[model samples]
Structures are given as structure tokens and as C-alpha cells.
Target chain A: MHEASAATAPGRGGRDLAISVRDLVVGFGDTLVVRGLDLDVYRGEVLGFVGGSGTGKSVLTRTILGLERKRSGRIEVFGEDLDKASAADHARIERRMGVMFQQGALFSNLTVKQNIQVPMREHLRLSPRFADELAMLKLALVGLDLDAADKLPAQLSGGMIKRAALARALALDPELVFLDEPTSGLDPIGAADFDELIATLQKTLGLTVFMVTHDLDSIYAICDRVAALAEGKVIAAGPISTLLASDHPWVHAYFHGTRARRFQDVQ
Target chain B: MEIPDGPTFKSSRSRDAITFELAGRWTIGASAALEDGARAVFAEASKVRRAVLDLGAVAALDTAGAWLIDKTRRELAAAGVEARLERVRPEYGILLEEAHYRQFEAPSGKRRLYAAVLLADIGESVVSFGKDVLAGVSFLGEVVASLLGTIIAPLRFRAISLVFHIEQIGFRSVPIIGLINFLVGCIVAQQGIFQLQRFGASTFAVDLIGILVLRELGVLLTSIMIAGRSGSAVTAEIGSMKMREEIDALKVMGLRPVEVLIVPRILALVISLPLLTFIADMAALFGGLLVAWGYGGINPAAFMARLQSAIGENTFLVGIIKAPFMALVIGIIASMEGLAVAGSAESLGRRVTASVVKSIFMVIVLDGFFAVFFAGIRY
Candidate 1:
């Protein structure tokens, strides 16, 4: 419902934002990777975050997840300021969100079903039977067969690994999910199917999806909106059409680039 | 749904048709009663031609309840009884459908291995052991070549990383090594005193502690401790780097992983082992001195004089001389295991454990060889 450019004032749109980052500066030692960056992800929208390699897209996502410390900034999630929240409130906020890391970050020691059950067991108390059943349900929900439930992450193919990780992300039935390069390793068909799956899941569950990706097909096919990052700042944010018309140099080159041409207007 | 106090079932028979009415909670909290009731009803229901299970009165349902219903239906079907479950709420229907989809298979029996399989495993292990030995020899050659190169061009050495590793494996480990050696010294003196007192030679405990601490225990214990503590850490660090492809990344950047990472760590261990052994030796002697005087009634002067006579320069030199070789064994074994790590957490753990075990085993064997060689030369 809310559509705005990257330079637009924060909280100006009518619809609520799931994640709001302002003046976020993250650095390691003397080098600044993300400086004075601002990002907004509106509720129930799949926001595809695009950037060149080593442009700090993963760093920014990690900062939002509280994995990396920010030099200076304020981050808000679900209407609560992250910096000022108490420990309990922080945990509550964390419980409402799920993350599927790029490598799937699956617990190698656990079976796929057990991995899905981890979030369920950590945040809720239920009988082991019910937990296992729910884990199977989640596995099925992610389009994995029942046999995949008993297999370890090491035993899965790349696409299966992504699906299993997605299943684990949806285990707790969170309102928000963060996916990093979810389809990077998959084949074209697998990647397209995955994008379709994510779109369906987002629409059905009313999830606020924050996806960091490099796949042009993914941005064009499923993302309700796209934000472009360059030189430690978000230079553009809008729908695919808006990004195509942008005059910024990096945005122009990225969207109209040779590799991106095939995917442009495919949606 | 609130769980009923207990699950109970009532059954009625009308000639060929049998109806079993299930009531109360069938969730996990009342699982025992639910199982019993289901078993009792199903056992008799199988005798009937037509069996119907009514669940309309059930107050609560979970995976456990669905499992019970599923199991009963399965058992009845197995008995050739035409059974039907009715009055299921749609909310609970999904639970039942999911339960039906997830029917757990019985675990397969334990693996039964044939003689060929056993023999193949042994052969594989022997071949792997041979490969490990070859790899170790080659790795040592590479390290020595790198060391020689650094010696020829001293600026090529990574002094900062070397210092960091030295501080990690040596300086930070002093307190623990000192305490363990000191305690070993005290225990040896106490036991020697207790045994020698029978022969009225309680003061001879000084000679026992002196010879053992100076000649064997000091270097051996220090080597063992380092193998367990720093050896495992080295393997884990390098193994993790290998697992994450950082070593490959270094190779891509036109750097040899051995020269950058392995050389600094091994050099640190080799250089610091003797220094650590010296500290352990001193702490052990001090501890023995205290126990000798306090427990054996040997005055400090007498104990010191006896210590000087009981062990000669060669005794001290024998332990100190073995420190570098022991350090080399630990460093080489640890780094070799780390480099051999595959891409898995399990592999890293296995490699680390093997590094410690193999280094300690080889160190003790090397010590035995040293003992024999030293005796041959009468050192």
C-alpha cells in the first residue's frame, strides 16, 4: 500500500512498515561498509533488496537481525524500537521473525524434521508427538515429500536444502521472514519454482518478506518492490517499472545491463 | 481444547454392527487411558464384521489422539474388520490426515556384517593409515622447506602471527601447566616418602622426585598437556578454516596456506615447547622441595644438596632436549589432521580428536625411543 523512494521521509506512507532502518552506519575497523543507509520494508510485501557483490547487503541484513553491531543508527521492527527494547521484548520480537540464511545454515547434526522442530520447541511447549507432526506438516507445506523429513541437510540437493530451510523458517508461523539469496544456487527452473513458492507463501500467510537477492528473475517475477543499494547507501526504491525508469547511473546500468535485459519486463 | 480428566470408551453391539463411542480427552495428557480404552475396544471390535468408531464427543485431540485413532483403524484393518471412523471435526481432520501421511516405519534391524565386509574395513583402515604416514612425511618436508626459505629470507616470516600464536599456546598456558606439574611433583614425593619410610630411607624421596621430575615427567607431562589443550585448538582452527574454504581463498590470493597459517603455528609451538618445559621443571622441583621438607622431615638444605647429587646435568638436558621434537610431533600431527578435514562439522570433530590422540601416542612412543637411545649413550 505504501510506495516511496529511498530518499523519502521515514514513516510517511499509510501502511505500516515491518522493518525501518534509519541513518544506519556499520563499520569494521577503519572501513565503512554501510554508511548512513536507510531502508524500509512495508508489511505484507516481498521487498527484493538488490546490490552488487560485496556491497554490504548481507551485512545490512545481519545488522537488522542483531547479529552484527551497528556503529550508529536506529532499527525498528513491528512498531518497537530495537535499541530501547527490554530483553523480554527483544526476544518477543525475535520470535515473531524467521531467517533463512544463504547456505540454508541447517543444523548439520539434525534431520530436516528435527531442524524444523527447533524453532517450534524453543518458543513453544508441546508434546513430542505433536511437535514431530507439526514438523512434518511444515515440511509438506514447503513442498518437500515425507521422505525428506528424515534426511539430513547433507543428504539433500541444493533445491531441497533451500526448501528444508524454508520449512524451518516457517516452523514457528512467524509474521516476518528474512531470506538471503534463497535461489542463488538452484537451477533456473528450481529458482523459478522457488520464487513462485515464496510468492504463494507470502500471499497466503500475509508475511512481510525481506529477501536479499542477486537474481534478476526473482526481482522481476515475485518482488512487489525492489530497493537498489550502491556505495553504502540505498539509492533507489520502488516497483520494477520505477527502477527501470530511474536515472541513477548504477540503477540504470544494473536494470538495463546485458544480464538483466532478458529478465526485464518478464513479469 | 481443555483435556478431560481421563479418556473412557463405551461400546454397543447390534447383531453384526458394533459402535464404539469414545469420550473425554484423547490428547497426550490422557494418552495412557486413551491407549488402554482404544486397545480394549479394538480387540473386541475386530471380532465384529462391521466396526464404527464415533469421535463426536471427544473434547480434545492432538497428534497423540490422532495416532490412537489411526493405530486402532490400522489394527482393525489388519484383523480384516471393516471399520469406519465418523463424526470427526474438520479442524481435527487435518491432524488425522497429517498423521496418516506420516506413518512411521519400523526401524531396520542392526547391521549384520559379513566377513568380507569386516576384512574390507580393516584393509581400508590400514591403507588410510599408510596414506596418513605418507602425508605426514610430505607435510613435514614442506614445512622444513618453508622454514629454510624463511631462514634464507627472514623478512618472509610472519612475525606478528608467530607472536600471536606463541602468546596463545605458551604464555596463556603457563598457569595451568605449572599447577599440574606442581601437583604431580607433590604426589610423587608423598608416595615415595610413604614407601621409603619402611626401609628408614624416607629422605630418599628427594632422589625419586628429583630423577623423575627432571628426566621424564617434566617434558612428558608438558607435551601431553599441550597436545590436549593447544593441539586440539590448532586442529579445530585450521580444520574450520579448511571447512569454510578460507584456505582455498588464500590459495586464490596467490598465497600458500602452509607458509601463511601452518608455518606460524608450528614455529610457535616448536619455539615455545622448551620454554614451557623449563617452567614445568622448575615448578615441579619447587613442589617436590616443599613436600620433601614438610612430609619427609628433610630440611631444605639437605633436600637441595641431595637434589644436586641425585640428578646430574645430563638428567636435566635429556628432558629439555626432547622438547623440540615433541613439539614438532604435536604441530605436524595437528596441522596434518586439520588439512585432512572434509566439509562437515563431524569431520572437523573427528579430525581434532584424531590429532590429539595421534600426537599423544606418537609423543609417548618418541619418548620411549629417546629413553632407549639415551641409555645406549649413557646420558
Candidate 2:
């Protein structure tokens, strides 16, 4: 419990922070979705971001990725202040980061192979032979067959879309990855397989993963640290054990509720 | 942390044996350097009988890094040099094993070009055209069966659906259709007057406008306009519904989507096209009359007398007779395209385009056939 008292101050990791957001105020129209929020995502750890529906879990993630505007805030990725970054600096920071949107968001007209090559073509100048082989290597890393490369996104099943999206996100070998609701629509077995895959990738690639999720099983399975967002702010940020020990009414209730029995089963 | 430098290697050789020590990021960002280094390794390893790739000093590794290293190793082995990896981190080892060197053969669909290819293309287009006709006929049979079933069990007929679609397809189309027909009528009358006046037969322009407006142009224009507007709308709606599996959802619930979706729309078209054609005819005649009085110096009464004498009752009936068939062609084509929608937004767009273009072409073709039939019967 004492560890959470100053948790919002960020960075028990000190100089190793992958993402540091301070006093972030994000809103749409008159309604403030994320108000006065502060959070930290340290390097080389899987941070699971959880919030109730419409609580702006996605908004905050999008804000950090610069996909959404913030009314007032300071955001830093890999020690480069987002607001202060020059265009070139921003591109530099962006090239090392990847995002897998909630829906696959693959180009509807492109085959999966072309979809994977889009970012590679943008940022790297590789011979087409090397590019093709690299794309196949990525496809295999995410457990997709090379045959699926010629198919369009519409031809893929829901679970395959997730995997393909993940493959595209990893196309650049990004050090930091944002995954939004990675296991929401997947069946239980599929979700478990996905959780294991994420765990393996995070470990082997040394990737810093920031996942926004409502899947309790995913939270229990792979998240190295869990951040609970409520009231337009992060109420608690720590490991699963630390969150379970907190006495805040919502945090206590959410982690110990009937649904949390699954957490119990996980333990 | 500072950006790591590109991959570099230190190699040592002693009598038929060589060790290449690799270092640096070896990530995709350093791909160019990695390629040069791999080339350097291959050039050195070919002269030796045995080769070893040591990765103990590498700072970072990704699939691309692993792949490049594995490629060099395979290139050496293929050149008859015994090669293997050494001191690789377990994670890099797994990455290497996963992205092991393999050849991806391009599909063998490329055939040599020939004049026969042109003939083949023509044959394919003809076959596809035949398939489209067959598909349309089958779709027509299904709708007819549903229409008959509804007729036999009148209690199950969807009257409200028919009326609702009539409003969407016909009532909403009136303003644009009327305005365009009026403008077209004015243009045709002005052109007729200009051409005929040079021949000292300017008053004959009145008869031309009367017969053309009453018999052919009015209904054809109305049908073409509707095909672009409401026909496209119907195809888009049904195509999107099919994309989302809503059509299949209705079938699983034991409801015939053809009865619920296609029949009412087609019936509404059948009921609405003639009424719209009548509107188009009157609007165009009014426009032609105004032009005749203003531009051709024909008084209102003179123009009215000439128009009444030039157009017969059969002339009006002949134009209205084509309306229902035009409606059927548009409805059948639009509905068939909608049902054929596969699971993509691009497919929906393509189906809507095909619906509009095919229906308009078929409308013109059907009108030509009717013209030939009426001429044969001397109607």
C-alpha cells in the first residue's frame, strides 16, 4: 500500500521510462474524458491499462501516441518531449513505436503482404528481395502462414486479423508497442494463446508493451504491471499484487469482485 | 540510451577454418550496414573450408537481424563451405530458428503472350456476359416465385414495404427528374426550331417536340435518371446488408429475404415507373410548349393545336408501355448485384457501379427491341 502512495509520481524506473505523461488533460467538446492524469510506462515491461467502458482508456493511449489532441499536457516518449520535438525528431520517435488498433485497420483494398510492406516502404530503403523475405519472417513471427499473405483483410477470421495487425505493428521492430483490446473478441482458448504470444514476444524482443484491455484473464495472465484508470485519472498504478492490496473502494471492489474470482482461479 | 552503431564483424582464419565475430545493433534500422557486413562475411567465408558466425557481442537483434545472419550462413553452406553459428544468445537463437533461410517461389501463373491471348480475353468476356445473363434470369425466377406466393397468400404480402419503397424510390425522385426533363425539352425544342427555320418549316418543330416527348425521349430519360439515382441507392443498401450478413441472418430466422427485401422494391418500381414517366412526359411537353411560343413565334393556341394533331393516343401509350420493362430491368440488375456482394467495401462499390451501368445499357437495349417490335406490328 505504501508503494502506491507516490505511484502517480512516475518512474520508480528513473531514467529508463519508455513513456512519461504528466498532467494530461484531454476532452471532447465540453466533457473532459481524461482530466489531470499522470502515468508512467517503464521500459521492457508489459503495462496493462484498465478502465470501465467509456472511461477513456483508449483516449489516453491515443493521446500519448499523438493520435488525439490533449487540451493541456506534457508527453515524453524515449526522453524526447512530444510537444518540443521537431518534425524530424517526431519522426524518429514515431519510427520506433507501433500501434495495433482495436480493429485491424488494415487497408481494405490491399493484400496482407502489401499491408505489411507499407511501413517498410515508407521508412526503410531495402531491396525488394530483402523486403519480401522480411515480410515473410514477420508473418511467421506472429504465427501466420505465408499463404495468408495473399489474402485480404476481409478474408481473415477475427483472430487472424488480430495476429495480422500485430504483425504489421512489429514490422519496424519497434521498441515500444501499443495494443488496444488485444483479446476482447477472441474465445477463451484463443485469448490464452494470444496472451502467451504477447508474453513471448515481449520477452524475446525486449519490447515495452502498453496494452489497453478489459479482459481480466489477460490482465492476470501477462501484464507485468496494471494501471487502473477512473474518474479521468489513474487511481492506482502498480503490479497485480499491489493493486489487489489497495483499499481504494473501486480498486478494491474491482479486483475482489465476483468477476475477480477469475483472478482467483488464475492465481 | 544512444543509438547503437551498425553491425561490424571481426574475423580470424587459420588454415581452412575461420571465425567471424559479429557486433552492433543488426536491427532493421541498420539494415544497409547489415547487408554490407553479410556480403563481407560471404566473401571471406567462401575461401575457407569451415566457417563459424559468432554473435556473442551483438547489442540488439530482431527478426530482420536474425534473417540476415541466417541468410549469410545458408549462402556459405550453399557454396560448399561447412558453416555454423557460435555463441548466439538463446533469444537470438530462437529468432534465427524461426526465420531460417528458405526460398519463396513466386506463383507460376505467367504464360507467354500471344495473339491467342487477345482471343482468350474476348472469350472470357463473352463467357462472363453469358454468366451475368444466367444469373439475372435465375434471380428473376426467384423473385417471380416469391411474387406468386405473395399473390396466392395475399395475407403475407408486404404492402407497407412496397409503399415505403415507393416513397424512397419514386416520390423522392420527382423534383430532379421533372427539372431535368423540362431543361432537356427546352434544349431539344430550341435546336429543332433553329434547324427547321432555315428550311422554312419552323412550325414543324412543334410536331417533333410533341412526338418525341410523348413517345421515346421522356420515358428513356426518366428511366436512365432513376437508374443512376434510386437504382444505385437500392443496390448500395442491399449490398451493405449482404456484406454484414444481415441477409443470411434473415434466412436463418426462416424468413425469405427475397420476399422481404427484393419483391417489395421491385413491385414498387413496377408501380412507380409509369407514374414517373407520365410526370416526365407532361413536364417535357410543358417545357416544349413554352419554347415554341417564345422562340419559334408560335402562339399558345397554334402550338397546342399542332401538338394535339401530331401525337396520337397510341404515341403516348407506346412510351408508357416501355416504363414497366425498364423498371423491371433496373430492379432485377440492382437486386442481383446486391445479392452478389462479397465481404468488402470495395465489392459494394463495384456492385453498385455495375448495377447502374448495366441497368442503363439494358434499358436502352430493351427500348430498341420494343421499337423494332412496334414497327413490325405497325402500332
Candidate 3:
């Protein structure tokens, strides 16, 4: 795992940082959800965000994607400040990034095949045959068969839905991927398998992953760095080992507390 | 006088004229027993001219019980036997009266005018059909090709998935339509009663209910309801999908959200709204019947008879004609609102509300136009 992490690091690979977020604050109405959060995502690195519920991990991610309005912030993706980017520039940035929602959020009415093909059809000028081939490739990458592609989201199991959503996220061959609770609700084995898949994909595709999750197992297995958030603040941020050994009460409780101890025991 | 207790038989030697002495609350728990009792009564009344239903001991009856009785009566009538209420309890009598038992009568000439309004709905349908055809031709193979490409390329599947999004936006929105139709029926009956009673033409309530329900209220109400319910649902569903990065995913993979998601929902809503309106019309009429029998002292039979006499075949045809046009308005409004949905849940809610209100308002306005246009015509 260490060797795999070293191989994908931006400096080692001679690639530039993929995302740089500085002093980002997001609020809803008059209430702030994300306050003064700063983070950096290097190319091909899996950056995991661990926080209690309502700490604005999702809000921060959405702000980066321009889906949520930022009260104040500087978010640069591929060296472009997305906050001030034009509609066309935003679209260009979006073309290079893919997102997988926590719920899988698969289009309920669409069949799996259609769901996989949606991105390809939207951004590219590909022919029908070419699009089908692209969709099939992505499905295969997620270890899903062509038969699964024809089934609707309602028909797929929870695990399969997540896999399908992953297939969709990878459909654009994005340089950066945002996954909100990618291993959430999955059993330990499924989550482990997902972790392995993410690790393998990150190495093979050289994709930068920004994941928000509370799953300690995922952080240990796939994440190169971890960021802890609490009460609308980044309480700690650094390499997983560094944050785990930190003296901060919240960090210690989150990373070395009873829950973490239990997670460690599972391995 | 205390009626002598007789033996309860599934099939008796005498003509089938037996009643279950329901002493407790009449609820769904007795459904099986009620079915058995109805079957027994039907079998025994084979040679009888009329079957008497005694409900004096029935303490309470709900919609299920009422439906059971209605079903039993219909079955008895099918066998050329009349079913009469004998010693009906006050509550059951009220329930029966509420169901329009006293308002059954043939329709009148005013009902024909209502039918003409329904016929006018067809004009709107033709316009929608043209729009759908145009949309279909414009998008055509591009949608199919985009979906196909997702199967082959590593990152192209996002585009392909968008083609099927239209079904979510359009096809599964019937519940909203049904709900709106039910409410519209209640409001129309309530308002109609108020207007008719002012002129001391209370009996004409039957004629008004029939004509309005069959021709004007049924079609008009249904169209407006669909516009609000399905239209708003469609808009919100698509808009939220857009906000969730799902639309962007498709675009990044080179798929047209308009061709893939918007078109199919538009088509589905356009096709489904008219059919939904037909169902809505029936529901509204049923609602009117309930209101009429409950407050207007009209029996279901006389009410139906007056409805038949007052509402000619043309009124029904006219109502049907309006359905497609109503469908078009709903489809267009919903799709437009959906496309306009910004990337947020709040936007989804706002757009959905706007879509429903706008579509219903437009449908009502269009209904007025049809009324005036038909009023001026010789037909």
C-alpha cells in the first residue's frame, strides 16, 4: 500500500496539484455550514475527509464543484479559480471531474447501461456504437456484466448500485473524482473490496480522489492523507498516521478511540 | 316491532333475501364474510323479483363496506333482480345518500353543452402531437448513439444513461394527478352548490353536477390537476437530477440532456396526461355524486338518470377532446421548469411549485377560451 501511494504522488509522478482549496466558507441562509476550510489535493492522491455528521464535508465538496454558493473562498481546480470562472470555464472544469453520490443516486428510471452511457453522450461527439462500447468498458471496469447494465437502479442491489454509480463517475475518465461516502452502508467485506477497487483504480488511472467518509477502514486502506472536520472547522489535517497520533481530543477520539479500536480489530 | 330472527343461510330454499345482522362496527375485517353473504344472497335471489337488504343493525360502514354493497347491488341487477334497502339504519342511510343513491336520473340539454367543451380539448392534443413529433425528429438517433457509446468507451457511459431519464420525469407521476383530480372535484361541487342554491334552482344541482362533471369540470379539472401534479413532479425530478451533477456527468461524456432526459419525459407526460384526465373525469364525477347525495338530498339513481339526460354523448366527447390539449400544457410547462431548475434542492422545490401553479393557471385560462369559443358557435 505504501509503495502504491508513493507511485501515485504528484511529485513522484511529475504531475501538478489537481485541486487547491483555501479559506473556503459555505453558508446556508444565515447559518454557516463550512467555515474557513483549507485543503490541497495533489494529482493521483486519495484524500479522505473524516468528520461527524453536519460538519459540512459534503457542503465543502459541493462548493468546490460550484453546486453550492460559497460565502467566501478560493477553489482552484487545475490552477483555475472556479469561483470566478465563466459558465464555459466551469463546464470545461466539470468535464475533467466525476462525482459519485453517497446514495449511489443512480437515475431510478434509467437502466444501468443507460446510466453508464449518460456522461459519454453528454460531453462527447461520439457515435452510437462508440458510446455503447464506452459504456460497456466502464461497466466491465466496475466488475459488472453487460446484463446488469440493462436493469434499472431499483432492480440493482445496494452494492451493485454503488458499483454502477462508480462506473458512471469513471465514465468521463476524469482526472479528479469526488466520492461522498463511497463505502457507506456496505458490509465490511464489500467496503474492503471497494477500498481495493479505489486503490487499484487510483494507481492504474492516476486519478485524484477526494472522498468524504467516516469509515476508518477506508481511510487506512486507501487514503494517503486524512482531514478531520468538526463544528464547521478543520480540526486536523495531514497524513493519516500524523493525524492519528495527534493530541487533539477530537482527532484522538476519531482515530484511536473505541470506534477506531474496533475498526482496527477488524483487520 | 321486534322483527323475528331467522336462520342465516348461504343458500336458502326461499328466494335469496337474507341480510347479515351487523351489530358491531362494519369494517374491513368483515370483508370475507360480506363477500360470502353477498354471494349467498345472489344465489338465493335467482327466482326473486327483488332482494331486500336489511342494514338496520349495521352500526357503522366505511368506504369498503359501501363499495361491497354497491358491488352486491350491481351483481343482483345483472341477474335481472332489483335490490331494495329494507330497514336501513340511519347512518347507513346517510352513507347511501352521500353516495348519490337519490340523484340517479337521465341527463339534460345543459349537459350537452358541457360535452361540447370536452370535444374542444382535441385541438390542444393536435398541437402537442406536432410538438412531440418535432422533438422526436430533432433529437432522433443522437440519443441512441450517445447511449450506445457509453457501452464501449471507458468514460463515455455517463452520456448513454441520460436517454432513459425521461421516464422518471414523466411516466411515474400519476399519483399527483389522481390527488389533484380528487381535490378539484370537491371544490367544483362545493362551489356549484353555492351558485345553484342562490337562484332557488336546487334541483338543478343534479343537472349542474352532471354537466359540469362530465363536460367542463371533469376535463377542465383533470387537465389543471395534471398540469400541477405531473407537471411539477416532472420539473422537480429532472431539476434535481440536474443539480446532483447527473446532468453534468452526461454532458461531460457528450450526451444531450435535452434529447436524453427532457424529450422522453415530455413525450410520456404528453401521452399520459389525456389518459390521466379521463380517469380524473371519472373521479370528479364520482366526487360530485358524493357531494350531491350528501348535501343536495339527491339519490344516486335519480342523480345518474339526470346526469345521463343532461350530459349527452357530445359532452363526454368534448371533455375527452380537451384532455390532449391539457396534456400539452402540462408537458410543456413541466419540461420548461425542469430545464430551468438550478443546481440545488431549493431550486427543485421552487420550480416544481411554479410548474404546478403555472400549468394549472394556464389550463384554467385555456378552459375559459374554449368556453367562450364554444358558446359563440352554432353547434
What is the per-residue lDDT of model 3 for residues B17-116, given as tens digits with 9 covering 90 to 100? 5443434434333434544554566676656767766666665554334444655677778888877666776656554443321212221335557667
Top-scoring candidate (lDDT): 2
Q: Whole-model Cα lDDT per candidate?
A: 0.87, 0.89, 0.69
RMSD of each: 7.9, 3.1, 33.5
Candidate 1: TM-score?
0.66
Query: TM-scores across all candidates?
Result: 0.66, 0.91, 0.44
Q: Which run of 10 residues does model 1 chain A get worst, by summed lDDT?
A: A1-10
Reference-based lDDT, residue B8, model 3: 32
Output the better candidate (1/3) by TM-score: 1
The list of candidate 2 runs beyond 4 A from truth reads: A1-5, A9-11, A247-254, B9-23, B49-59, B82-94, B103-125
lDDT of 3: 0.69
- Backbone clashes, candidate 1: 0
Q: How is the predicted docking of candidate 3 categorized under the CAPRI scheme? A: incorrect
Per-residue lDDT of A105-206 in model 1, one digit per residue for the tens?
999989998999887677665667656766776776688887888788888999999999998988766779999999999999999999998987776556
DockQ, per-model, please? 0.07, 0.57, 0.01
